[model samples]
Target chain A: MTTRSPLRIEPTTPPDESPPMRPSDPLPALPPPKPDPATVPDPVISARSLCVWYGSSMALKNVDIDIPRHKITALIGPSGCGKSTLLRCFNRMNDLIPGARMEGTIKFEGIELADPSIDAVALRRRVGMVFQKPNPFPKSIYQNVAWGARINGYKGDMDELVEKSLRRAALWEEVRGKLHKSGLDLSGGQQQRLCIARTLAVEPEIILMDEPCSALDPIATAKVEDLMDELKEDYTIVIVTHNMQQARRTSDMTACLMLDEAAVQGGHRTGVIAEFSPTEKLFTNPSDPRTEAYITGRIG
Target chain B: MNLPVPSGSVERPRWPAPSRFRRYQGPVMLSLLAICALVTVLTTIGIVAVLGLETIHFFRESHVSLPAFVFGTEVDPPKFGIFPLIWGTVMVAAGASLIALPIGLLSALYLSEYAPRRVRAVLKPALELLAGIPTIVYGFLALVLVTPLLKACFEPLGLKVDSYNALSACVVVGVMIIPMVSSLSEDVLSAVPRSLREAAYGLGATKFEVSTRIVLPAGLSGVAASFILAISRAVGETMAVVLAAGRMPNVTANPLRSVETMTAYIVAITGGDASYGTPKYLSLFAVGMTLFVMTLGLNILSGLILRRFREVYN
Candidate 1:
């Protein structure tokens, strides 16, 4: 009955919520304070001064972040703000994109990922990924979970491995009777869990998920969020999400990224980390004005 | 008035009334397109009618018997057994598949999974150019070039290689249909969702593994359909076999010997003078009918394969 233009910015500040911060305010020179060492786990993968580019356009600039061991770290931001790009950089997935180049160092368990001698295949075995959309191979349910282990030369009992992976993904109970059926025959939520099971079968220490629940219904999203909570006891996770509430509900650490308007050149704004802090503090008391604007839904 | 009337009370006139021509345009265009579609169907029916009538006339002749024409091996008084012709066709087609299937599949995999964009842009059209060349030119090439090369290479090994042989025809025909298999298979392989490839890559699979294990299996139905279609092309091919494999209708498996295929025999009979309603003229219809049945069967099989194994992605 009525048309509400998306571009119309009505800055409504609810009485209980903090006031909307203006974009003109200067950002802090230093990054947000890190959590106390006694309270947080040690860093497993660290990126310092990481910069990525697609041809002449800079996608990510001077990104510095540490992924703590056995904890869920969420990267939340607007579209084209390099959330997916940064997540892809963790496992060297960016190498697949033509003309995508990165400058700077990324260390995964004391090994420099960018070093020419480091085999991407071996690195990927230790760090698997689940995509934004569920992408189970056009295979049977059992084979979808076993294919990775088979290729990686796993000598263990395959039936046990498949069951273990499925159970870990919280999908074994639903799919136990139909392991021979086509993976595509599963519901959307079941398919996403199958993808997670497939990643788990590789025995990876860390899992990178790129908006894993964006294509799922609320029930599926909640299921995946719960699975992440359970998985963090053993596997470190770094998830990129457009849903800020999902980040708050599932993550221990949170990072907000936004386009650097001051650094805009030729109509392209490079992505930079606006704030990085504990999930609770980042939500309750954001240091950056842009982070507050994004968190309060006043601006993206 | 104390109260304002509701919006439903307003009766605004249209700026321009809908035209009758606009309403009729869809049905008129549809009828024209239906006529265009019926042309191919009519042509197919016409061919079947002609072939059936002539074949019936051939079988009705007093000298001809179904068993003798299909199974007997007599040479005197000219027994019309089609075994040798059918055997020649099968041999040539099978040999061509040996050479073409692997080469075409590998090239399709390279173009779809490994070749850079600029390389594919330049290479794909060049590969398709193989199909655009006239079949007669390939016939000439098989007759002169490939036969001489095969003879020169095999004679040194103390093996006899005929000047007009089935081997040369098979090689050239195989090369001729390479574009058909590779192009169609490449289109299918490329149609597979990028997410599937990314999923495999994220699971620590190598590029070769991803191409062979994931993409290949996903596109297998289309690739097989392409293979069947290429085989049909080989079976129906005429000029190349006639040129390189001379008119000797012996049913032998040796690739070095000269062989006459069913298509080659039809071309030989039709190109020469054969009066209408004569057994010789009527024989052409029988062979043509057989060829039509083979190709139609293959086309149907290809369509069924495509329908049965096609993957749906959301």
Candidate 2:
């Protein structure tokens, strides 16, 4: 076939659309209007000047954020930005990591969470977590759901508790047939749901998820997103995601993290929040240049 | 206008490569491995054959009636009863298990779950060093050091403890096998995925609860295997038992009394006490067979327990 005018180049942008330039187009010099703290409801958990160090080096620096109750807050960052580390601070999961140390105060439910007098185990009972990958215990489906409840001294009908938690996680119908079989026998998505059911069985008021859908298929990710939409009624959720689309799809509030370069903060390249706002405001009208560059796929 | 084609094609040999190295290596290597496998089977069959022949000769020539030899305890003219030896072996193994199971499992938990990295790095190799120490040293320690201490402790309780008693051997054997159980169980416990621990900790479980409930159950197969292997070592233990426990064939249930084990009896008879080819010498083979059977039984028990309770992960 003869080449016709060396392959015609057409505008990919549709006529009626804004041609994708509105987000990046230059406007009058204007700064993001900071939200008034008085108008916003009191946060369920608030971090003040939070800093974290690993051994002799810092990992996070001056991270201040408020997590609203019963609402989903998404933490988006590039790799090594310490989003997972911040999630761990909520229930003191960082204590398990050796040489990990934190500075500054974190208030949960208007009560300071970092006080030495607080028991981590008790705090964890009130705040649960799901990990990046599906981590179902090598146990029966029923036992996986019931273990957290039994350990937390749930005196209620355990059979009903397991059923209720599974239903809440939207896993009961899929796993109801094989309650006695090993949880490992299930697919990756089903196993993730089992972990969610296990966390729900503890009756935590808040849940921290570290990229919960990273290891899942798109269908499974959509299912989890749907589950989060329903779960916001009973549980405050904080999630760390590299997928910016996921933050917009599922979260009410969004925070973007970037590397703290040596140019401003000594020589260490720690992680710091570049911007935090409502998901719609953050995506449609980002406050920080770095966040816009990142969300637009310009930066790693 | 000619355009240059991209040279991405890989070079291929036409046929019958001049280099014959890779072609003949497979069967040659397979034959070498086959020989190695055959040697193991051959050695096992050879040992069984030798032991079996002598064991049968012992029964036939000794004429110490099988039922009587097994049941009767009289040994003046060599009644050849094995009750005392079996009892001694069982007691020492049972005692070793009692001591090693708790201490070894607990030490394993500390090493696997609680110890900091630097501490584990120093402690783990040191613990394995205990396993490297010769059993002969343990035997000497039991005879010289532990026996006296046990005697003194029992003296206060009005029990007459012999210089060569099963208690001393059992205690020393327990110490000897501690490393085996602890190290193997440590491996098992550490092999339990970090995700399980995170899940447990996320549920408000303390360190104690996480270690005991989640990690322990997850590592149950390896932990149970460690105990079985330790007990088998106790049963087959020769040098330590022979030194600490006297060679006297006294069938008694008391731990304070000196007792002979199958290994000790075999050693005593084979160490020139009985002439070669005699029924007494042949008895060594029979005792070896019994010890083999007992250890086999223990391994089978371990396999069954592992199969029943194993929560295998991908």
Candidate 3:
């Protein structure tokens, strides 16, 4: 809980210039895409008519979302609204849950993620995720950052990669002195940042965070929020949140999911997208009445 | 305001009183539980006392040399050495563990990490059934079936093995404890939280890497404990070793040679000879004491390994 603001004030670029990390930071690094008002930005990931089912009952139906590159996109709604489900879809992380199934197309870099020819392992190298709770591996903080990179055949200087990732997560100042210490020994906020650093060492193009600050105190939450804002300069982010203000404060665009009231097919209520717009428009002048009620705290 | 403040001084807080039965029944039940717990401790001490007293009597009353009795290989008349039996016990247990550890742990890994629900439901209980078979049945099988098979395999290769050989005992003992190791290891592996697996997979690790690096390491303490327990079981096994491994006091490391284990010596001596106060009768207690010490050491080692590597999950 020590003051964690100085790292944010500093620039995120590597201090001492070294040869670029090629294995992870894809060849010829694409500059972070600017969200220009005059032209439409290309979607880093585009899901078309996505439907998901857990066993027999449908969880989500015909949900479409275009997540812009190098910008924070927030998914917000009440519980059981399938916002987290949609976030996990970006990395095909839903495949891990038993009996959970998905249909329709989720395309990343113009390739369908669900295609059998595409390798999930290689796909995950470019699309990483941070979980709802801080889950740093039960290893030293140094190892926690180095493990993914090592397994992915990172041959460059691991020490430099570990330092740069920690700095990017805004966790370097507190933990650089104790890199060999267990990641589990950190406070809740630090642990979450360590998890983020673990994801960053792999050098993914997009990062998905599922309520990364829900377990943190207000001060720690602010620290992570600041880090997220800084992260958008390099990585495309998709975040799921119950906190509407967090969506407004951190994201460039926001998507709201709502449960279907009418009987879909089975007797169960299904979740679908109610609105998708720029964060400002979604908060202040939503086209959907439901989004306005949710923003104003009239209904959830 | 609709709410009214408390008037004057605050009264002493009222508390919910316990029912008469709730208040009075605790001591009675707790005493009953304490008695049950004390029974186990008392039983262990009673066994040790019986063995120790007889062992001390044997050492003192007999006109035998202590070093010769311990280190000698002869079993005729005055010198009754126990070293050969201890060596036999260690060799057989070690040989059996060599066979059991990898096969059992791999089966456990399959059940916990790779197998589907249908496969696990059928496989897990079938393994436990292997453990529940009577050891006497295993002894009968070893004597009748396994020894002949070993002789058939090795005799043509020019190794001589008796009808009752240590190889039969070690192999059968290994098979018997496969279920013991597999079942215990499966339980421990299953206790490893799924969140660790998810984290590894999210990092792009395959199922193999997740099971081996993440889940296996996290569950090390429990796996090590199961291994120690299995070794202890192998050390104390009696009936099968008696029927399969012959009653020869050969202390050699050759597994194909006929040998006698500590449990076998204890059982065979007491079955048909000498008065209660005789040196031969008292020898059984000395051997039993040695077996108890060996198992106790293993149990302590198991605890140490468990405390050192146990990964705490929040």
Q: Highest lDDT among the candidates is held by which one?
A: 1
| Residue-by-residue lDDT tens digits, candidate 2, B215-271 | 999999999989998999989888988898877767677888898888888788767
Candidate 1 chain A has its poorest 10 consecutive residues by lDDT at A1-10
Off by over 4 Å in 1: A1-41, B1-21, B62-67, B73-77, B299-314
Clashes of each: 0, 0, 0
User: All models: lDDT?
Assistant: 0.85, 0.84, 0.82
Identify the leading candidate in terms of DockQ: 2
lDDT of 1 at A189: 96
DockQ of each: 0.56, 0.64, 0.43
- Model 3 lDDT per residue over B135-211, tens place: 98989899889988998899999999888788899898998898888898899889887767777878888888888
Task: Kindly provide the TM-score of model 3 when superposed on the true structure, using C-alpha atoms.
Answer: 0.88
Sorted on DockQ, best first, the list reads 2, 1, 3
lDDT of 1 by residue, B200-259 (tens): 999999999999999998988889889998999999999888998887887787899998
- Model 3 chain A weakest lDDT span, ten residues long: A1-10
Predicted candidate 2 versus true structure: per-residue lDDT over A176-282, tens digit per residue = 88899999999888889899999999999999999999999999999899999999999999999999999999999998888764312344557777788889988
Candidate order, TM-score descending: 1, 2, 3
